[model samples]
Target: MVSPLFITTFTLLFVFHLNHTSTVRPKMHINIYMYINMCSSNILTNDCLPPLNDENDFLPPLNDENDFLPPLNDEIDFLPPLNDENDFIPPLNDENDYKKFAIKIPEKWKKKEWIKWMKQTEEDWLVFNTYIIKKKKKWLARKEIKWKNWIRGMEKKWMHYNPHIYREFKSNTMKKSQSWDDTQWARWIETEGKDFMEIEWEKWIYQNNKYINEWIMNQWLQWKNKKIMQWLMNSWKCEEDEYWETWERSTIWEKWFNLRKRRKWLRWHNRINKETDQWNKWVKSKEVIYTKEANNKLLEWINEKRNSFNNWKKSFIDKWIHKKQWIVWIREKQNLPCTI
Candidate 1:
């Protein structure tokens, strides 16, 4: 039930208040590009204003129209090919470049390409070589430190418990002993003469010379024997030994002479009978004893013998020899056939 004049006056007062407030408040200087970027496509309409070309705007200026366009095919065609060999390898003027080149070497490169890539100027080669030498030294130093630490750890953990380690240590000691020259031997004898001589004598007493036949056949031993004969003749010992009959000057000599006589008799017996003596001393010295390689070789020889025996059996059966002497042949060749 409001009057028309009162309604008109209220409308005019509201409009005046809005105008006064707008004039009194500070103007907001928004970037036109920012507004465009933030404004959603769905909300943009014909009512939206065009962007202003204000130089003082806080937003960056727009690039030209050509900047957004793709390059022409003709322009690309005028440029060098991307796969050019020269373009692939950048110049290695410094150590850093050399390292990078070495690290980034392509797996698929041809030998020729690799050679070409590796080729460098004298100055560049020096730098590269220096870098490589330094790197290798550092690597070796680190490796040596790691190896020392590992050895220390192993020694602490298994030095007393491991038999293999003890054996290896003994083998190394033997090698070092065998490698000693006259001076080193003299020095060692000076320091540990009694203990060393005792150990050596014990070993000599326990073990016979396994290489006696080889030693007898050695040229140096033959020369020494001739010299000994000359010395014996000059000293008149040869004349004195004429009625000795046996070279048994001492108990040791008599024992060795008896052993040699027995061995010679056994060897003659074996040759005459064409039978092997199982207890022959030379059998142990032969390469067929107590080693992995020897065992393998023995197995192979046995297999060959077995195969030959089988072939011989087949032949004997075809020839009707099996009917006549089957049991005898089988008994003779049961262990390892001499004929087959």
Candidate 2:
């Protein structure tokens, strides 16, 4: 039911709009207000038709399953260590597990004295084994040192061609203009246009042997000055640290009296029979087979092979380790004097 007055007024406005506008203008312009209202109502009632994929629209959507992720796993996550549990750790691994120590006394034998003996024996065996290990370590260390010396000698021989490498190093070291005071410092301009003085004494001067020596000297002088002041004040007690006449005249008090006594006794004991009695702290040096010694020993052996009597004597003293029929040979040749 369009009102005739309203329709007539709209037709007159449309004609006026056409007369003012260019050729691009349409004959009539639809009222957007009424069209928008109508379209919205139809959509709400599904008369305009819903989205094609309305089923997906109702349900929730999922992620791509390969989107931006958080931080990944670590080594501890895959194979958690044994200590991850609250239990205490067990005993150590041993290359040479001497079963003698591992041997345990039976439950029935626990009452016997052999149980205690076994424990003591095991401890003693362990101590003895360490001695063997130390000897082995010493031997290995000596061998290593020898090889090192040989390598060092070769390096030195090569370096003789040009000794300037060390000189160049020294020059580079000297070129760094930083003095002791300014070694850890840098000059900087301040915000106020003045020089900034950042004195980081902690990082600048670390505790070292040189500083220690200087400190000790300063301490000694300070102590001496204090003592002199006390003497001048006439307040120096005779027995400042002891029962005495004057601090200096009193019974001599040695800081290392006990230490001196121990050293004196130790030195006196050292004068006694040393070869059999002394347990030397010095490790016995390795006896490396030098070329001269090896050659001499080899030549003597070869010479002994040539001599008729030496040959016969050598047969008797022949190494039995390689001989297969050694047991039978020993029985048949009973008179053959054993050399080993």
Candidate 3:
């Protein structure tokens, strides 16, 4: 019951609408692509993006929904603009500037904060060091001038206070030289040339004998003891010849000779007493107080004398002197019989 004209018109309008959408869809896609390309290419221009209804509406989607945005504290928000001259971060190319900023860092910062600050400032420090190295010669020249001025001032003050410093310095140098002569050089000479030194000393003593005698007499007058002089003379004589005849004739030798004569007489008397005891049959022997060491020494000496006498006896027999004359000579010399 619908009119034919109305149905035809409705169908034609729907076909036309489909064809227009198909043709325009591709053009719209192409326009969007061109717009994105233009925006990327002119990103720094003011007209890069169409104005948005809200600035936050066009933000890219983030991976985490709760990620923190920048702090909006008044201190940060009200900071001078980045391009402002007053807020400009000066290049830390000067050493003083680097030290100033470095000293400003707090000592109590956490490790992560310290690391972050070091990473941020490392480039500036390197740049400042390079600048210093490039100007090193000029800096050193200035330092040298300052050092010379300070030295000159010190010298002037020293001269005002003590004008004898140079003389004292020279004296110290002489003392050092004298010390070397006294210690190291003297030691070297003593060690390396000892025989040469001994010969020189002998020559000196021979040359200076008159003076040395005078000095000895003066020393003896001061000491006033003949024993010391005797000891010195004995020592000198011993050094010349230890077994000299004069040394054998000393007082000690005389005392030893007398002791030996008494010992021999005692022995002969004891022998005579023993012979009489054999006849009388009851005479007791005398006791001598000899220490163990003295007895051992006496025995050794007696053995030595007995061996010598035996050697002489053999010689006498070979020479045909083992007669009555030899027996009488032995009795006179030792007071003992030659035979048993």
Candidate 4:
């Protein structure tokens, strides 16, 4: 026979193992499944005992169809749908909908405190203000004509009170207005004839009354705009060709300037040509003189220094013979005449 303490210890060990682990179908010798079914049935109805299925998030199958539990997949609220059309999901609050749609309400719903000052009159507000001011002034004037007349006389005396203010107000309101330029005169003359009397001029002008005039103005405006743009582009700080105008070159009197510069340049060229001809004659004469003088000097030098002078003069003469006299003459005369 097994010892009683050993049997008790073995039973306690098995119970602890079943409580702590999964797959705890009691592996006893007989009627194992019957015991499990009875235990499950007892566990469901027992309120004091916490659910074993609660840990695994399991709920019992519901028998009733109209239960509040959410439907699977395409889940919707079950109680009631609150839209005129089934297609719309109704926003619960009407005020929220009004704000969402940006609806404007009447003046009665207006929120401005200052609106209390706006009086309700029989006439439209715009018209009524004018009548009210006129009526007030007329009634005040009739009741006190002497006072009004006195105030009118005082207007002259009031100028001394604030002379600058009156002067400024008068200057601002009373302006010397300028008439517009005669646009018809300014627009390019339409016909070969100057007057409006020519048959072709009249016909052409009549044919192109409104439409063509606008087109011409647009073209002129475009041309002027382009010219201004080009001038701006080709200014000193720019990188394009310029549109220099008569006004822009106001400092330059072109017709007189062109004539002046032409006369000056021609005069200088004439002087220079005379100088160049004279220079050439002088150079040729010097060449002969130099040849003679150089030969005489070479002979005298040779006589003085003998063979040493011959050596130096030979190199000098060689260099002189090769030298371009014209080029040298121009370089000296014009100071950097060569393009290079």
Candidate 5:
């Protein structure tokens, strides 16, 4: 959209320059006049013009999908396909499941030491079994003593009221007592004397250490394996955690070193400035004032409600005392009036 005046001025300058040069060389006059007319016509048509594409739009259109190379299918599954060899999760019952916990095995003991440890564990297990047996025996002896005392006490209680019943009970208990096992006694109590028995003798027998020891012995191996597995797992986790901590600390140290080389002073100054600004902002904040105002209003509301309730209660009690003339209120309330 060039101004017509600008175009006319530019044409006049071109013609004047050609005329001035032609006067010095009349032979070039015709050629110069033809060149001027050609230039003037090109300017009028606006054909000898600027480039079609701007600097930013200079590149050809990218219509090829291959040129853009659809961003690496990031969502595609990269994991290995499921198979029996790789698909199985290590089960707690699997013997090989203990391997995840075996990371620190070498750190804790050498091959020879591990062998010694195994031998020691075996010995300890045997000793523990023997101790458990002894404990069971002691517990059985204690239970027998307690059972005898309980029987004696029950008999004594009955002796004061019914000597005959106590005598019969005692006789039955004493008869074949030396040959009577807990199971036999249990059978006798359930079948013959269960109705007469005051105490739950069978329950007491089951609670005895003998039965408890039997159950413990049955599960001992599994329990030991679980504890060893737990120890191994904990050791492995602790080692792994220590490694992670070391890595994190080293990373922080390197970061701090790089920071010191670049903007340590700037960071420190910014931190101090931020802290001061935060303190000032806190001092100016209306949150504390608003909270206090809300609390005051809440307290006032609570006091008003309490006073209103107390006044209502007082008025109700006064009316009850003055208006209700019931002479037997206590008996009426209990609903248990006595008849004369």
Candidate 6:
């Protein structure tokens, strides 16, 4: 027979297990509820119960879902209000007793308070000015270091390729030869002109000179654009200071001006008003002009090349064979025995 103590202990364990399982796994909570009902029914029937050696032997493992517990309701009340009759006593001092929460002081005290406020303001302004100066100097020094490093890097790259002798020499010997000299130089200009007419040669020379001039113009425009961009970046920090100017509020204006109008003026003054499109327009116009000029120059060069080629063909025929010589050469080619 099961003892009374063992039955009570098993009942307590079942209650605790049910309460814990109800929060973790609701589905297993139903099984535990049924098991609890069986235990109670057996107890009522005075059924004999087996002794449990361990809590685990009495309560089986539940499912693994760990649902959140419902939040507990707070039961404590807030602090009670103070009874004015028992706790609070009205002040019995005069209006000028130096304790009233008012901004307008008696005329006698105004001078002393004004001097104290002015002294504090002067100290604050001096500290702020010193900080601003230090910050500006630090920012400028950092930018100067970056600029110097960039210049040093560029110089290193330039020095790697350029010889120091070029700097030492002053005459034309220091200058590099033109790129075209590597191609035709003296041979083509001297030999090719012998067969061609003076007019044809003059036309070619003029066309070539025009091409060189157009190339030089392109290089100049590119260099000008780079310089402009560099200068703009170097001066960028100071370009918009006028737009950020603050409007000083005089005592009279502060007292009389509407708050809404003052706010509107502040908003307008704080915005950047400078037009950035002027530089964009200038760059666009320059690009369009350069593109058009380059196209025209290219077309002229192509036409000149075609004309020079035709002139060379004509001059070659004149220098070599006339109609009879050409016919004789064709007959000899046709009469030659076939190698096959």
TM-score of each: 0.15, 0.14, 0.14, 0.13, 0.25, 0.22
Encode model 2's per-residue lDDT on 1-340: one tens digit a residue. Answer: 7565565556456545544542221211233233334453432233222223333232222243222222224212122233322221234254223221112112122122223433554465356446544654454455445534643453343222223423532322122322412212111111110111112112212322234335434543464355334432321111111221122243345323444323323332342223113212111111122123433543453344236333432342232222322333333335555443
User: Which pairs of residues have clashing backbones in candidate 1?
Assistant: none
Reference-based lDDT, each prediction: 0.38, 0.32, 0.38, 0.34, 0.44, 0.41
Whose TM-score is higher: candidate 4's or candidate 6's? 6
Best by lDDT: 5
Clash count (model 6, backbone only): 0
- Candidate 6 residue-wise lDDT, 14-43, digit = tens: 678556653324544455566556565555
Clash pairs (backbone) in predicted model 3: none
Per-residue lDDT value at 146 in model 6: 50
Sort order, lDDT high to low: 5, 6, 3, 1, 4, 2
Model 4 regions more than 4 Å off: 1-257, 300-340
What TM-score does model 6 achieve against the real structure? 0.22
Give the CA lDDT, 0 to 100, for residue 14 in model 1.
Answer: 49
Error of 5 at 114 (Å): 4.9
- The digit string of per-residue lDDT tens for model 3 on 1-340 reads 6564554555456445544543233444454345455544433344422343454533443444232234333222223444432333456776556544332222222123324533544454355435433444454355446534643553343222233434633323222323353344334323432333234334533443344334434443443244224432432223322332333456765536555333323333453354345423311110111123324543454455446434543453333222323223334345564552
Name the runs in model 3 displaced over 4 angstroms: 1-121, 133-137, 161-340
20-39: candidate 4 lDDT, tens digit per residue: 55333223312233434434
Candidate 3 weakest ten by summed lDDT = 282-291
- Across 1-340, the per-residue lDDT of candidate 1 in tens digits comes to 6565564555456445544443211222233233343343333444333334453322322354342233445322223444654554667687555543432332223223323422422244355436544654564456446544643453243212222432433333223555555455445334443243334333432332223223323533454345334433532223223323233334665545455333333333343233123212322333232234434543454455446434543453333332323223233434434343
Please report how far candidate 6 places residue 6 from its true position, in Å: 76
Candidate 5: where is the Cα deviation over 4 Å? 1-116, 158-194, 209-340
Evaluation by TM-score, superior candidate among 2 and 5: 5
